[model samples]
Target: MTMEDKREPKRRNPAKTQARILDAAFELFSSQGYARTGMREVAERADVATSLVVRYFGTKAALFEQALVRAIYERGFFVRSKPNFGERMAALVVGDEEARIPAMMVLAIADLESREIAQKITRDVVLKSLADWLGPPDAQNRALHMLTLMNGFTIQTRHLRTGDVPPESVRWLARSLQAIVDEENAPVN
Candidate 1:
């Protein structure tokens, strides 16, 4: 095959290439922390040129922001998928290391502090969606409480990486969250 023909396979598909770059940035930022990671490292890991990474994302901060947005988006934090979702989410917090919620929390806390865009996404996309799923009249308050607990659980499992959290504790946490779900669905007096 001609060299030009061989090189043709590597041509960028805009969506796919962008996804790959985001995936690479997510992994690197999660593992290394955002400040420590660089655009070149993300490019190398994504197997794309640094220029391409910059071309798509402009700045390292923008890349990191997009990565964060993608992670939150993937969790479907606002969508009510099923009954007992709190239990399911709690189970996920315990079991799904690859979910990266814990790592994302660290990134927000450590690097993205004072970034209005990040705050806006968290407040608008995540918090609002979660509150909406819980439904009114106390939905926002309930969501805030649940998020606090959920984040705490994620930190314990993902960041602390402590030996298996006691199964009973997991069960209790799930049950607590389940109670909230039950309340949300309960008939009004």
Candidate 2:
């Protein structure tokens, strides 16, 4: 080939590469924490050379971000899939449609985890979307708080521990959050 032709590197399909890398990272990271997942593992899973992962994601940190983002969106956190916050939250509480939140939690607490990145994305992409479609700031906080409560609650529920939060408390929390939203949206004198 001519020097000009040699200089022109073959342009691989970006979307396909992104999906393959994400799929590989998701499998590895979901099973093993970020630190434990190596580029080789993802490459093997993706049926691509390890260098391709580096080319696509730059670093494992970046790869993890793509993996997590895809997992969240791919979990079916969309309105067409489920139209209500209760349904959405409930899915998360038990397990999302993808059953990856528990794995995500473990991954998030890993040394390489980036809660700042996670929260920002969660808020900007996940929470903000839900808020705009659902309600206001209070609704936003409510969703966040509920997520925390569910996290703890699910752990206890799994162990069948005593002093568990009653169903009524969950109901109260939901109603109170709604009240806060209503109060904020109320007309000022």
Candidate 3:
């Protein structure tokens, strides 16, 4: 065999490493929250070094944004179901009433902060991407209606989860809103 036979294949996959960091970041971030979790903690949890986490993700905010993005990605809800925004928004309350903390964290992020983050959450998930699906709002009020309904459902369901699945509570809100949208979407008499 030639000396070139001695060469070993690459041991670490960049994709796998990046995924590990992201997974660890999400675990720590979701449990402890962005403000509480540190790069060191994520690196330790991922079994990588602290510098590696920082090198890959930069500051805490950058790492956190990535983690939040991961949470959204792992959900992969939009891709699988591909429902209308209002339907998808209603769906959250319909399924999985067991745990809501992480989503509550997402809501808390919007509630606690005042910056581009809030707008990004609103624009990226609650509005533009999904709105683009709906083919443009008829008016400003209509836009607000869709956005607020989605962005607050988790927070709204906080009380409902304490007892039963709260179908009546969730359906009341979902159907009431759906009624108006459905009515507006209906053919004129």
Candidate 4:
């Protein structure tokens, strides 16, 4: 009997494989954007067959949406209290490079459908949740303002390659965001 014949083939776990694929997809999409990221590249990064990626995700858009949603939820941005929301957001924008993925995705994707998906996720999931958490007295508008501030800051930091944001700058940004949350400095509407 040949020794090679006795070896057992590796078992496949669908759930783990899907998770790995999603993680790989998120990494690629975030770094390369949807237009530049390919399914084969995702499969390669996940260390799986390209056919498996297509079978699981169906299309690049579907995969992009799923990966983006998963990344957003994993961030847990909405779980924090409103009292220090500004400070938390400012810290994320200034210090957490990983936290900038959503904004990066939004700016980087050029394809119409993929761009729409990114925008929709940003508005529907992120904006809606933040507005809901803020609650009343122009919560929607305030949340929009907060998102704009954070997104703009994220882009600026990335483009300018600003390292180690000054403590005073962070504090200033925090105060500006906190003012929006507090609604004390909001203009009459």
How do the predictions measure up, each by TM-score? Answer: 0.84, 0.65, 0.66, 0.85
- The per-model lDDT (C-alpha) reads 0.76, 0.64, 0.59, 0.81
lDDT of 3: 0.59
TM-score of 3: 0.66
Pull out the clashing pairs in model 1. Answer: none
Q: After best superposition, candidate 3 residue 180: deviation in angstroms?
A: 6.8
Worst 10 residues of 3 by lDDT: 97-106
Candidate 1's residue-wise lDDT over 1-189, tens digit each? 888876755454899999999999888877667778889999999998999999999998788878878977776655756576767777777775544755665555666541455577668877787788878658888877777777777777767866878888788778877777667667777
lDDT of each residue in 1-189, candidate 4, tens digit only: 688899899899998999999999988877667788899999999999999999999999899889888888888787777688888888877765665565556555578888888888878888998888777788888889988877767666655655766788778889988888888445658
Best model per lDDT = 4
Model 2 scores worst on lDDT over the 10 consecutive residues at: 80-89
Clashes of 1: 0
Between candidates 2 and 3, the one scoring higher on TM-score is 3
Question: TM-score winner among the candidates?
Answer: 4
TM-score, candidate number 2: 0.65
Give the Å shift of residue 75 in candidate 4.
Answer: 1.7
Give the range of the ten consecutive residues with the poorest summed lDDT in model 1. Answer: 108-117
Order of models, best lDDT first: 4, 1, 2, 3
lDDT of 3 by residue, 23-70 (tens): 887777655555677788899999999998888888876776666666
lDDT of 4: 0.81
